[model samples]
Target: MNVLKPLSGSTLALLACMAAGALCGLVAEPAGALAYLFGQLYLAVVNMAAMPLLVVATFFGLRQVCELPRPAWRVGTIGALALGLMVLCGVAGTLAGALAMPGAHLPEHAYATFGERLLQSAGDAQEVGVTLFDGADAAVSQTSAYGWREAVPDNFYRVLAQGHPLGILAGTLLFGLAFAALSREQTSMLGNVFEGVYRTLEIIIERANLLIPVLAFGTAAWVSAHTPPAMLAAMGSFLVCFLACAAVLGGAATALTARRAGLPLVQIVASLKAPLLVGLTSGSATASIPHTIEAMSARLGFSRGIVELIVPFGAVFVRAGSALYFSLATVFVANLYDRPLGAGDFAVIAFASVGAAFLSSGKSGVATVGYMGVVLSLLQLPAEAASVLFVTIDLICEGPRNVVSLLAVCAVIALVSAGLPSERVMPEPLRAQPQVRAPLRFALSRGQLALVAGCAMTVASLIVLMGIGVGAK
Candidate 1:
């Protein structure tokens, strides 16, 4: 029982998926393709929930930030620091990619195959071209003409239904602020309702995450089976560069966290093992929040005031890992196409990567790809092929990406807690919750079963239609 207790469901799932994916990659061609399809289908389903999850989560998170103790500057300071770290990581990754030159000198046949797959997956080259460049002038002109007209939504429902995530985020923030302005009784009532919704969404998101291992397996098998051996070597170089950058940043974050928390680096790392393992296996810092808060408040003895405020805010806003990947990926794709990146191009990558990190964090299934597309377009590089290829190996990078983000959160918590007055710290009795051991069950609820069925049917229909479309072609 003790041995079994140590292995979490996500850890077991990760190992199982790795083994299955490697076996399929080596000996199962048709199965690999099918697995890839399932992976995409799973991503699509998960993505359907990402916007709502982020919207409600951010809404409540902002409330916490707004209600922070009198020195509002503390929250702002932590936020600024987190943002700086994110951008710094991005710059580092870009520099590393520039030096490493991953994916450079790819074999012609491998490049051609990737290009063909990209074109097929993306479809409508004309549309891609227009979206890539044509909107820039209009966007710039609109920005120049900014007024109430630009800020006000003509149709709020349309903005949400059409999946304008930034618009939704803006709306949620505005609503959160308005709620904060309400009378105490009214605010509490509404806040409770919103919190309930947020908790429910969190549960759904957690359940959806159980599919991650299957998604990882399918993606790994497909990439291994389809990609050329030389291309794989190039990808290996990119992975090394990315991992190296993340490790350096992560190590620095650990040192800072330990220093700020007044604990040894080893102690801090040891204390974070549960959250770190969960973050790595789940590939989500957001999903690891409960454990992170528990670790910080209970094990590490941080005050609730600091723990409750910074951790959630950091989870949604601080995205060092995503920023790093975006910068590294942009450089890698540029190299694959033999596109030369000057200083100006690197600057654009850095800025765009940071901007995209904020815009796409808390979303699902390689949100970085969309942001990378924007970066590619800005650099006048062909984006679709690169975007597709990036998605292929996104799962492989997710674990490290999440770990970096978690470490950033911990670092911010430590920094914020250290700066607060000693009196602001919670008393020991309030700081620790009694440990409760309960039987662990691994069964799905009825609602989860229904959701699975619905997703399966939707995915099947989409796959069938896709097959028919291919046959027609």
Candidate 2:
């Protein structure tokens, strides 16, 4: 049995902010520019925290794994489970698109609307002396540049510096394994350093979370104001179809977890609400890491070590959410282009989708959508117009995607982590507990100062970029 509480205050506030922002944006679109600045600043901070969190978390998870009995088997089992589920998710999404036929039977009004949108886009492109498909052409031509080397890079430092997720994941995984394999005498100082960094970063994120509601409001306003309402209406079927698949995938995962954990569904929801809300609002699992770990371990009665291992690792490499997105988007594009989809086409789409989903990690917005073009090119579909509509109204789409991804984490843990939580440690909630005494503090370590500097520089640069955009207007 689990002891998860009801939805936390922050979760409710985030939802309210998003709703308010949507309504406000629909009514007062003029504030969008201001909102964009706030939204970017918030995301930039999250981005700043992400890489360091990844390294520290990888250390924690891998060290825990190595301590567990039969560590190699546990790692292999988790990998196989994640990979298989992601593949099935891709196939399921493609099947939903095929059955729904969202893009095939567009209303007459939608046809006119889509035609005008394309013409306007083409006009804009022509004014700049480039075709609408030029980007896709250049993109397809560069496909050869990505390969196994990029996935498991030899130049770890270069890729780490560039903030590539796959490279970071590979490098940190190997580093953590080596660290865990070393004698405690040899690794104690570095282990303590990693633990301190993780704790410090957690505190930093907790403090920064005060801006989440404002970020939600700004992000909602920014999306609503920029995207045409009519465009959303015109493609409502695709949105609905995507949402339906997400519901199926998410519901199944939740139900399975509840059944296996012997916990009631309401209790499961109570435990997960915070992380799920954060995921939906921020669309960054890294931002939800602390909430996710506590909820799964302390509230939902799973192993903290296992929860930590899966959340970050699964967020980076598993990518069931991206698999679903790629599969459905590919099928929708095929239908939109009037390309015939054969049995073989579905097979190709499924496999390509899984691969593309893995490759699209660490990317967001337009960069994430660009992977859809790779699948489209393989099937000879017109990729240009297909993505334009999706991009225009992606904010709504991303919430479901992020939520599904988070649920996938829980689902894996529930299925694979079957033991009871006998060794769980319950601490007072961070807000409820007050510090007994202030510790004697010295000046910041050089490493800590460097981290603070990096975060400050990242946020400042993004704000400056936002200002440049505002000035151009």
Among these predictions, the greatest TM-score belongs to 2
Error of 2 at 443 (Å): 66
Error of 1 at 366 (Å): 4.9
325-426: candidate 2 lDDT, tens digit per residue = 888988877777678898999998998888787777767656777777777777776666666667776777777877887788788887767554442344
Report how far off residue 57 is in candidate 2 (Å). 0.9
Worst 10 residues of 2 by lDDT: 1-10
Total clashing pairs in model 2: 0
For residues 332-430, write the lDDT of model 1, one tens digit per residue.
888877789899999989978887677665554566566566566677765655777777677778888888988988887777766556514543444
Q: Which stretches of candidate 1 lie over 4 Å from their true place?
A: 1-6, 9-13, 24-71, 105-165, 181-230, 283-285, 303-312, 422-473
Residue pairs with backbone overlap in model 1: none
Compared with the true structure, all predictions reach lDDT values of 0.70, 0.77
